[model samples]
Target chain A: MSVRHALLGLLSEGPKYGHQLRQEFEERTGDVWPLNVGQVYTTLQRLERDGLVESDDTASEGTQNVYRITGAGVDELGIWLHTPPDLTSPPRDELVIKVLVALRMPALDVRDVLQVHRRYLVELMQQWTRLKEDEGEFDFALALVVDSELFRLDSVIRWLDAVDGRLKRAEIEPPVAVPELPRLRRRLAVRR
Target chain B: MNVLELREVTKAYGEGMAQVHAIENVSLSVERGALVAIMGPSGSGKSTLLTIAGSLEEPTSGEVFIEGAPLSTMSHNEKARLRRQTLGFVFQDFNLLPGLTAAENVSLPLELDGMKAKKAHTIAMSMLGEFGLGDRASHFPDQLSGGERQRVAIARAVIGNRHLLLADEPSGALDSVNGEAVMRMILNACKQSGVAAVVVTHEAQLASWADRVVFLRDGHVVDQTVPPPTPEQLVHTAQQR
Candidate 1:
């Protein structure tokens, strides 16, 4: 997700100018994520400033200053690739928030709200599937992208089913309220 | 063409006092070259629906069709011949014969359908090779790994250009990674052969590989919808109208 690291990683391949870097990036990712030429150059400049990359003045063509990854850049890329992403904190998911807020409001049928979102997610999944088929027989990069989206949406749909099941059970048998008197009486008996 | 269709099909068991409807008024149609997934919790009639669709079991009342010909119109021999010729089933257990080699197991269905044993074996071996199992062709079922066995089962099911496939939890016994491989093989084979298929699976991830998913609940068709149109479909529809 970090364009900074992506550019640094690309530079590790060898010296590359602005346009070449953009083209290679798109080609490798099956053009699923497009990078702006200006953004690429700006990131390259920042990498040069931070000593992560250096411009090859000798290989420079007209308006095309080639950049190569420094020793430090190789180390940085290595660390980034080996480091595990921080997933301890949950992201701000709109669907989760909506379900929670709906649970508090009795006027809203939470199941109905969940079903609507579930349908939308399924539609998105189908759209991704269609895209994968369109990409043709041997598009590995696109296959990975489609698989990731489909798995994420499938997990969300499973969660909705879980919530629906729990709510249905709660309706059939109202959740029992914990009575405070039993604990107090048990404590007194134990003391006696 | 509709390779398989079930109209208002219902299957109930037992007498009045202990009657249980395994499937109730479930209508489904699968056209050639289509892959439809039937997903539901256990005992929700997923298997029942598949059995009826494949004509392995008859519905208590309702019409079943294969290639637009009503199943009820066929005699017992005719129905049996139809199934042997047009339908193939992949079971959760792999269902390969222990006495036969991988190639023999794959070739058995074709041989039973009256193809020459030598010719059937050759076709089976080639299909196995395509699935990266050519090396295991001579090995018996007990010698093959679980994934290999499942792959062989699939090869057998799709052999002889069978137009329809019914799979009951095809990936059930394999690990997740192997299960995914099996799923991809099924999808690729279906697309390549233009065979219509109905897969009964509890795994949602597997179901996502389907062209459309049909959800069943207590034997009822609770949800059924086709996936968004592919580019080929859009073009085909445009040409039609």
Candidate 2:
């Protein structure tokens, strides 16, 4: 998510090359988010250009340039570690959009659409649970990552159930008739 | 042979104008060593199906067979014997006898079936050890934690030569960590001991441990599917990325 801040945080420990940073990043994140070595180098270059990190090209034995966090980099990482992520705005969720669109279609039963998606989400949650079960007891990082995903999916399911309940209580009437479209009529006439 | 089979089973309550079908025309079969999970909203007949399958309740129509023996033909005593020898049950509440130690609670089934108390206690001790509860064998149900109690219950469920297990929200009383641990134990029992299991749970994540998941809706089977890919397959795909 914030690979720049992550790279800076890793460098704040000590001087490290791009490949080593990538390894530590994967390890700390519990391997859920795989970091590409090339992307790591690219972020390092951007950090160097921004003066948040300094690369010591002369101290390296080979062509691999070791990088260290600057004073500004440490300040930025510290700020990021304390700042809470922005969650004020509602996310653009595909499932929510699908349900909204399905409500307007007379031919579609919105409840059926909800059930289909609910089943899929449940299956996905199951997969994550299996992964958690297979993980070792000492692997707290990965377990936490899996737990977060499970909780997130569980919330989505709860939302779907709530919507279903509201719809049942509302007893909204179905469309009286399918709306006629002039464009469809024109296309049918041309085909004939 | 299939450990449990339901042939077009329909369970109805009341009669005439007030009749209600709890589960209608539901057919399912569970092979030995396979675990099946049934999930649905409240009053969706998930528990009804489980009870009928376990032969605790007779289906109003159709038939149920366990290990190829039709339940309709079994006499009352025969059914009781089958339940004692061939079936095991796990409930949401641990259901251990408060007065008995864990070892006695687990060995009660065998002792009821006429096994010597000493022999049953020895077998129960070994089973508790397998479940990592050997030291807790002397403890009462009230002395063990929720997870430990559930583990002891499971150990009791599969302790003897039980061929099938029927569980109703066995992990409902525990938190997510302990819940998952209970499911892991159930999965291990099914896989390692070739025990056919039918579990009724509201949590889909717990159901995912099963080989198949059956969804119920308003007294009818809505859908059934094999669970998603195994953890090994998922990890392999992630690594490829």
Candidate 3:
């Protein structure tokens, strides 16, 4: 989600100054990711520098400058939208790091740490749930935001449960060490 | 009017040292045209509360009421008849009979209550049509998709003016999209017919569709809240900071 690409995409609609682009971006994304006006202008300047967008000399009455997407900008936007996000390696997740570190500590129960985090995630999910209820017939963008947050939190909770179950099972029997996937037990070899 | 009520409801299993109190003096009421959701972890006694409220089991020492009438005063046959006529249930597995077609499945409850089969089929078809399954009337449960099967189960549950709809993790077997579709159907049923519903689920998102949510833990009602918080608040707070 490059700000430059977002501005180019917005300009694809027509000529839009920095303020208008900021408003449109917030509106379309359900204001989940609000953009600062200064940041918007900075990105627009960079986009103009890169020849992805060009500023118009023809003055529209109330605005300082109107930028339109160039052919190159259109091409760039197309490519960016089509490109799949990289998922080769896991992103740095704070909760995952915390849980892994907690598991190594002798004094703390990893399950208890997982429970604390699970409760927080559940509370966050509840907040999103409340937002959906308040919206009643939710707007498309708002609904998507709420739905994604709920699903993500739900998955995290499920992962916690899986980790807790596996940890308990490992306690009952000595776990086999696997170098690549520490803390995860290796599967037993089956007879053919 | 309150369609369902529980007063000091306590359900216990076994006796003496082995006794486990599934529900402990929990009281709740669902008004006409309202949907209430009960949420808790496993062993939290959510199912016990629903079963006692539905009159499937007698509470050891509490009162259950449906449509302002007390369950304790009713005879066994009266209670059975009440369940058949006034109460309905939707389950996680859908519980549709494989031998019956969609229309037949929806109409079974009405027909069992002594309605003419033709009349029951008519009501069932109309309900099925409302659920967007009119074209699949002749299709058997095995032929329909999971969503369709659940819809049929819901239509059957609320058929013939059965005002109290009790569901236990009704969408537990569905994907998120299908789970939401099921919730919409249930919400529509409550709105269109003024039927009161109580759904027990672990999913808070699904519970958001209800008018009120009751959280239970250790077989006791810990908290109840009307309308949970929304996403806009978080975004606004972040923006402010």
DockQ of each: 0.24, 0.37, 0.27
Q: Which candidate gets the maximum TM-score versus the true structure?
A: 2
CA error at residue B169 for candidate 2, angstroms: 0.8
In candidate 3, what are the lDDT values of residues A26-83, reduced to their tens digit?
8877777888999998888888899999988776677589889999999999999999
Q: Please give the lDDT score for candidate 1.
A: 0.82
RMSD of 2: 7.0
Pull out the clashing pairs in model 1. none
| Candidate 3 C-alpha error for residue B54, in Å | 1.3
Model number 2 iRMSD: 2.2
Docking quality of model 1: it rates as acceptable
lDDT of 2 by residue, B1-241 (tens): 7999999999999999999999999999999999899988788898899888888999999999999999999999999999899999999998999999999999999999999999999999999998889999999999999999999999889978899999999999999889988988898898889999999987876886777888887788887765689877866666686
Top DockQ: which candidate number?
Answer: 2
Question: Deviation in angstroms for B152 in model 1?
Answer: 1.4
Candidate 2 Cα outliers beyond 4 Å, as residue runs: A12-14, A49-52, A60-63, A70-72, A136-139, A171-192, B236-241
lDDT of 3 at A91: 42
TM-score, first chain, each model:
0.84, 0.81, 0.81
